[model samples]
Target chain A: MKIKKVVELLNAKVVSGHDHLEAEVEFCFASDLMSDVLTVETENLLLLTGLANLQTIRTSEMSDISKIIFVRKKNATEEMIRLAAENEMILIECDYSMFKTSGILFSAGLKPVY
Target chain B: MMHFEFHVEGGNFLKAGAASSQLKKILKQLNVDPKTIKRVVVAMYEAEVNIVAHAYKGDIYIDIDTKKIEITLIDEGPGIPDIDLAMKQGFSTASSVVREMGFGAGMGLPNIKNNSDELTITSEVNKGTTVKFATYLNQ
Candidate 1:
């Protein structure tokens, strides 16, 4: 799925990298654990999580994850958003719970990178 | 061979990941294969976090070779009382502050082991700990 498709499907607010909406996503990894993200993830995979911190952004950076969907209405910190922008990643904020978002996106053809 | 060193300061949450971040940069500059680089970064990052989260202090020494990459993490801290249990995914001794920083999920060592080709750990109670990790260079 294209990243923009996820944005539209979730009705999420794009926090950064509005220009990369057309980027392709081969997989989506839903996790609140940075270890799992660092170990199992691949580039271009969308990360869905409720944990909002600079480490979330840092984890995305290390894994070259270009798209992040913040679930459960959790907001990313200002530093997190700024880092995401610097890292050229698309950050999204959504009100959907992680389980629901995963279901919605999974039903929309998103699969875990694991 | 390329050599690198990183200091792990105890109780410094903000600098916990500095070592792994720098190692990633170094690997990128050397044009190491992305797969190999990720192995090194993830493993080393786990070491860095362990130091800050559990130990008094640590120093990571790296030896990058064409055949293999080696990393050694030495720390003076409260040693692991049970190595077997600590290696489990859900085991953690991290404080709340570390958890608030998005880590301490108790997956660091397992992640390190999963990413590296070889790993060895040694610790002494009331003394310190050392972890050695190695990954083969792709032929």
Candidate 2:
């Protein structure tokens, strides 16, 4: 699904990387654990995480994950936004919990990384 | 051949992956294969986080060449007493603060082992630890 559609489906706010809205993503991984996030090796992936910190951005950078949705209304700090922007990652913030966000995206045709 | 050194301040969450990030950039500029670069970065980042989440101070030594990349991380802090136990997935000695930061689920070393072609660890309790790993570029 295109990230723009995901934004509309989850009512998510784009925190950074607006230029990537049109990007198509096939896989989504939801986790609060940055360690688990690093173990994933999928392309065109989206990360739905509640952990809003610099490490989250760092994890995404290492994993080559380009899109992130901060679930449970978690707000990305200024440092995180700056880092994500530098990594060219698209950061999204949503009020829904991780589970809910994952369900919505999965229902909307986002495949899991498993 | 190229060698680089980076210092890691223990318990400094914000700067945890700086060294790994820099290495990744250098590998990219060197036109290393993407898969090889990912393995190197993931292994290095996990090891880097281990230092930040547990050690008092650490240093990362990196050597890159046409055949492979070798990394050695030495830290001055409480060393692991049980290497076998520490290698278990989900075994962690990190504080609650580190756990809250989405780490400390005990996967760092295992992840490094999974990504590296060669791995070795040595430590002395209450003193320090050393982790060395290598990733072959041609793999």
Question: Could you say which candidate leads in TM-score?
Answer: 2
A7-94, model 1: which lDDT tens digit per residue? 8999989988899998888788888878778777466688998888877887776776778999999987887877788768888999
Model 1 docking tier (incorrect/acceptable/medium/high): medium
Q: Estimate each model's TM-score.
A: 0.91, 0.98
Error of 2 at B4 (Å): 0.5
Q: What is the lDDT of residue A88 in candidate 2?
A: 91
Instruction: Name the top DockQ candidate.
Output: 2
Specify the poorest-scoring 10-residue window by lDDT in model 1 chain B. Answer: B13-22
Report model 1's chain A TM-score: 0.94
Candidate 1 docks with a DockQ of 0.54
For candidate 2, write residues B1-139 as lDDT tens digits.
9999999999999898899899989999999989889999999999999999999999999999889899999999999999999999989988999988899998999999999999999999999999999999876
lDDT of 1 by residue, B1-139 (tens): 8898888998886566767878888888889998788777878877887888889999999999898899999999999888889899899988988887778888999988888899999999989999999999985
> Candidate 1: lDDT of B38?
72
Residue runs of model 1 more than 4 Å from their true location after superposition: A41-43
Query: Where does model 2 exceed 4 Å of error?
Result: none
